[model samples]
Target: MLIDKPLPELRRYRGRNPRPADFTRYWREALRELDATPVQPELVPNREIDVPGVECFDLWFTGVGGARVYAKYLRPKAPIGRRHPAVLQFHGYSGNSGDWLGKVPYVAAGFCVAALDCRGQGGRSTDAGAVQGNTLNGHIIRGLDDPDDRKLLFRSLYLDTVQLARVVMSRPEVNPDRLGAMGASQGGGLTLACAALEPRIRRAAPVYPFLCDYQRVWEMDLAKDAYAELRDYFRRFDPCHEREADVFRKLGYIDCQHLAPMIKGEILMYTGLMDQICPPSTQFAAYNHIRARKEMVLYPDFGHEWLPGEADRTLRFMLPLAR
Candidate 1:
């Protein structure tokens, strides 16, 4: 189906974000009813690992429960260093840290980078001269029919996100206070959650983040994973739209928007105006509720292709603080 629909009301507030709330109102409520859960960490410290110009180690941490999450600790070689600012990196939906294997701009810029592997997604860690660590990684779009299921599903994604981040910050060579988060698409959504849920996060840079306004985005657009799950859900049970909505209501309980407000830090969110995959209105819903220092870069023509000069622009905004 074509991707165009009358979205819920998204209006601007006086000297603030849109107050004329819509779907976010209900979604945020459910997230609150379910208290923020702590992410558990299982350190795989100092295992000999190799990347490009930098050396790295693998850190395996459990998500909400036994959900094994992976992260790569990348660092520029420095024989003498006690503390350095760290950047917790996340990959897009269905991507892994290896996708960023060659991007040494961050570490070369003098920041410790920990690119986290989204649990259940395809691919495994195969660093040079390092033992391979492979396991059953679940897809995020699975088990969308209910919250108890999502708490188990998303909890792994969310916790692996923060726990690896926590490990990055706790490193003897990194400053825990100067920690920040960045990602695109689904990773962007996880970035929002990590910054909010992890108190150690001082700043965030999310580009074309998915998972902001969940119910609303799912309603207007139909894509893959998150959106496809909903579409198939309705397809299988056409009898009860109410049942699907109920499931969504429960899922919203753990969404990033509800968690964004709790994060007190600087935020830089990049959004595409015509993005069908992640409707702009959904981005605003979360952007507005942020009670932190923030800004948005809205692209008029961009759909989701890493915006022209967006990588540099995003880093420019972040450098004022992160550097």
Candidate 2:
């Protein structure tokens, strides 16, 4: 949660001159960036896990090279009237998949929800409470062999999120048109990127997302991974400085700044002024770049903790946002 951000007033761009173009460009870029391997997840239902009238299950999402990723999907047990709108949820970087177990708000509000487990992360239902106890190595930068591979490395986790949502939409009980994405911290960043990259998502809410403004993330040295990964990459390989810059530029091209605007759905971005992990300026940068109709909630004192009564506010906001 430690961030070395600069003075906020300095970077705050009150003058909005440039506008992000459209989602089409980002969508195509994501497709190009993704591998065309036969990626699929084997979803096995879990009748044991109890979710209020919603059948929840564990899913095994296979990544590009047959990497096994985990996910959890929840659907209304019995179809009520027509199919219900669905929400695919992701988790924070310092956290894992099951963190989204509290997503009953949307279900109780009459919707299906899919909460996915990020790979190399523990807090999966099968491995609950394991990583939290371990004073650990930074897993976010696990595959930082090269800067170009960082985003590619995150692909498995992010694609699992996107594909799991697509899987949920493939269900007869889910209203694909109403599908949306939501997450907090790193999850929030993923929510934004997934909403932008995955065109199917009609609504999005990114809360204190990580991995934005790569340059700033390195500057702040927030959590390890990113900086740690880059440092290690440069250290071990001693790659050309120019090569590293080019790699970061490509990474920036795939940055949330370029993608947030592409999300045509109603977006709700939330951040805290005191947030060390995600500086307010960077949050605002992404928010300002969001070309779609959106809303933002600023919490002055709250740090990494969940904002009190935020679910109600989100419900109220999303209920009316039936775009």
Best by TM-score: 1
lDDT of 1 by residue, 101-179 (tens): 5546777776788888765554463311132444333343345544444343564566556667766776788878888
lDDT of each: 0.65, 0.63
After superposing candidate 1, which stretches have Cα over 4 Å from the reference? 1-53, 99-101, 125-141, 144-150, 221-226, 320-323
The C-alpha stretches of model 2 lying farther than 4 A from their native spots are 1-36, 39-41, 99-101, 123-151, 220-244, 320-323
- Per-prediction TM-score, please? 0.78, 0.78
The TM-score of candidate 2 is 0.78
Weakest ten-residue segment in model 1 by summed lDDT: 13-22
Looking at candidate 2, what is the lDDT of residue 32? Answer: 55
- Residue 155 displacement (Å), model 2: 3.3
Looking at model 2, which ten-residue stretch has the lowest summed lDDT?
A: 126-135
